[model samples]
Target: MRRSGVVRGWRLVALVAAALAIAVVGVLAARAVLDAPALRDFFSRYPGTTERPEAAPYGFPAWLQWQHFLNAFLLVFIVKSGLQIRAKQRPPAFVTRRNTGLITTKRPPRRLGLHVWWHLVVDTLWVLNGVIYFVLLFASGQWLRLVPLTWDVIPNAISAGIQYAAFQWPLHDGWVHYNALQQLFYAATVFLAGPLALVTGLRLSPIFTQRDSWFTRRFTETAARRLHWAIMVYFLAFTVVHVTLVVTTGALRNLNAMYAGRHDESWIGLAIFAVSLVVMVLGWFVARPALLTRLAERGNDVRRMK
Candidate 1:
């Protein structure tokens, strides 16, 4: 039976609530066990340090601040539209006239055409932003801050994990230093997850299907789709944990660094963050299928003209 939109919405809410409840229970249990003498000894033995080579100055530049904002903005739209596309359950609204010969298994609803269009559009923007970020990061030599240079990072990351489990936050000076765990996570997000997402997305595109090559054979559409979904899950989990730590550990200082490009603990950054958040929320409301369809049609027109 086809469920009403309200019923589906409630189901989503229930699922999210269940997940949060499980997370809370898991955290409490971990905390109860994390402080045991054996575990404490193990953590102390590691005693991780945040040492890095040729570290840049511990301050956010104007460019970095703007990049951060753009990344967050693009990510929000990408994730939202991506989810909408995934939720589709009937045939595509329109099919290409060209015979690309790509398999189409799932029949998505007509409305999903808009979702897919928005997802692709925002994904392109996100990739461009990432490219710019990479160039500037390496050029400025700030990549050292995220990419670990030593094998000790593994053990140190474990120690950092223990600290987090015990509710004792690690020292965080993001402008200057990040704990071993933070460094590893950031490195994975940048060098691994980001590239994997882009590659998997491209693999699903018609452009890849049009060209028969060893690359396409190795990364089949099915594999690409599954990996893309997994990447989305990873991003969602990372965002949740990252935000929780940011707010719980030190909101003011973190906000100051990212938003205001300052080290001081002030409300200015928080205010700016709040305004930015409002804009994002407003965007979320206005990003309807009708608007997306119009945008997608315009894009198609431009492509044909080209």
Candidate 2:
């Protein structure tokens, strides 16, 4: 049965609350059983350093701030539309190609055309944004901050993970240096998750289904759907954890560095972030299926005319 929005929201809240409670209990239990020094030593295997040639020119740039905002904006819509598409229970609407006599909408439910269109639109924008981000990141030498240069990053990441779990909170100064865990997570998000998400999304597209090639044969639609869903879940989890860390670790400094491009501890960054958030919330309401459907139809008409 289709659930009401309020019911779904409450269920989500309950789920998150339960998860947090369980995590808190687990951490407490672990700390009770393990000696303080032993726990610290176990987690402190790999040492992180503030001194590295790769950490030159600290603080966020204007381009980085813009990219970050764009990324967040696109990701919010992408995830929302993706969830809507996945949750569609009714049959999907079909679009027929007059020239090729091809029928699309074999996979998604009929009523999901708007969601699919929005997903594709946002996905395209996200990819373009990613391309720009990659170019700027490499060109500005900021890639060095995210990519691991030494093997010790592995152990250091593990140490950071432990510290986080135990509530000890690792030292965080993103303006200057990222802990091993942050570096690895950022790298995975950029290099691994981004490409995988794109590949899996493409695999589920109508063009891929129309082609009976070896590529489609190897990466079946079923597998692609599963991977796509997993990737979405990964993104959701990462967003939650990343936001939690930012707020708990140091909200002012983190927001300042990201939103204001400054390292100073001030409320200016928070104010900007709040404004961006209001925009995002407004976007969520504005990107309704009815509105998006009209936009998609106009886009299709333009394409047909061309």
Give the whole-model CA lDDT for all candidates, comma-separated. 0.77, 0.78
User: How well is each residue in 1-306 modelled by candidate 1, as lDDT tens digits?
Assistant: 356888999999999999999878867866765667766766666665557576555777888888888888888888887887678744234323222246333432122254565677788889998999999999888788888898988988877786687577766678677789988998999899999999999897666756679999887888999999999999989989988888887899999988999898989989999998998887788886655555666424212211
Clashes of each: 5, 5
Worst 10 residues of 2 by lDDT: 91-100
- For every candidate structure, what is the RMSD over all alpha carbons to the true structure, in angstroms? 7.0, 6.2
lDDT of 1: 0.77
List TM-score per model, in order. 0.79, 0.81
Model 2 residue 286 CA deviation in Å: 0.6
As a TM-score, model 1 comes out at: 0.79
Candidate 2 residue lDDT tens string, 1-306: 356888999999999999999999978865553346656665445544323555456788999999999898888899888888788843133222223224334454222265676788799999999999999999988888788888878877776766676677777789888888999899999999999999999998766866899999999999999999999999889999998898888899999999999888889999999999999998888986556645656424212211
lDDT for predicted candidate 2 compared with the true structure: 0.78
Give the Cα error of residue 126 in candidate 2, in Å: 0.4
